[model samples]
Target: MNENRRWSTRENDRVLDEIAKRQQNLRKTIQLNRKEESDSVCLHDKLMSEI
Candidate 1:
């Protein structure tokens, strides 16, 4: 009974850790994508200016 309780707590912690990692990764991905989009827009604007 005590062992089962311990295992349940451990499982919960593991699940929470996984969720945090995923959230961090998602935030990073969004930032990178935004940066990439801005870069492309800048390039497009430069091309238009040149033309």
Candidate 2:
């Protein structure tokens, strides 16, 4: 019984770690997309001002 409990705990830990990693990746992707959008807006404004 104790061994089974230990195995369960390890599996839970691994699942939690995987979830955390995916969350981190999603956050980074969102941040990157936001940055790209802001940069595009800035470029558009600059071009409009020149014209």
Candidate 3:
């Protein structure tokens, strides 16, 4: 029974770690997209100013 409990705890920890990793990746992707969008807007404004 103790061994089973230990296995269960390890499995839970592994699942939690996977979830954390996915969340981190999602945050990074969002930040990157936002940065790209801001850069594009700036470029557009700069071009418009020149014209």
Candidate 4:
């Protein structure tokens, strides 16, 4: 019974770690996308002003 419990605990820890890593990656992706969008907007504005 104790061994089973230990195995379950390890599995739970691994699942939690994977979830955390995915969340971090998602956050980084969102940040990068936002930066790209903002840059595009700035470039658009600059082009309009030049015209």
Candidate 5:
């Protein structure tokens, strides 16, 4: 029974680690998207100024 409990705890820790990794990836993706959007806006303004 103790071994089973330890196995379950390890499994839970793995699941939590996976969740943390996914969340970190999600944050990075969001930040990248925001940067892309801001860059596009800057480009649009620059083009308009040239015209």
Candidate 6:
């Protein structure tokens, strides 16, 4: 019974770790998308100015 409890705890830790990794990746992706969006906006403004 003790062994089973230990296994369950390990499983929970593993799941939590996976969730943390996914969250980190999602944050990185969001940051990159925002940067790209801003860059495009800057480019658009530049083009408009030229015209």
Q: What does candidate 3's lDDT look like per residue over 1-51, in tens digits?
A: 999999988987886676567556656667758776566557556754764
Across 1-51, the per-residue lDDT of candidate 6 in tens digits comes to 999999988987886676567656656667758776566557556754764
Q: What RMSD does each model have against the real structure?
A: 16.8, 17.0, 17.0, 16.9, 17.1, 16.9
What C-alpha lDDT values do all the predictions have?
0.68, 0.68, 0.68, 0.68, 0.68, 0.68
Clashes of each: 0, 0, 0, 0, 0, 0
Candidate 4 weakest ten by summed lDDT: 39-48
Clashing pairs in 6: none
Per residue, candidate 5 scores C-alpha lDDT tens digits across 1-51 of: 999999988987886676567656656666758776566557556754764
| Residue 42, candidate 2: alpha-carbon lDDT | 72
TM-score of each: 0.56, 0.58, 0.57, 0.58, 0.58, 0.57
Per-residue error for 25 in candidate 3, Å, reads 0.2
Q: Which runs of model 4 end up more than 4 angstroms from their true locations? A: 32-51
RMSD of 2: 17.0
Please provide, for model 1 over 1-51, each residue's C-alpha lDDT reduced to its tens digit, 9 standing for 90 to 100: 999999988987886676567656656667758776566557556744763
**Candidate 2 worst ten-residue window by lDDT:** 39-48
Q: What is the lDDT of residue 43 in candidate 2?
A: 59
Which has the higher TM-score value, candidate number 1 or candidate number 2? 2
Candidate 1 Cα deviation (angstroms), residue 49: 53
Candidate 2, residue 47: lDDT: 50
After superposing candidate 3 on the true structure, give the runs of residues whose Cα lies further than 4 Å from its correct spot. Answer: 32-51
Model 2 quality (TM-score): 0.58
The collision pairs in model 5 are none
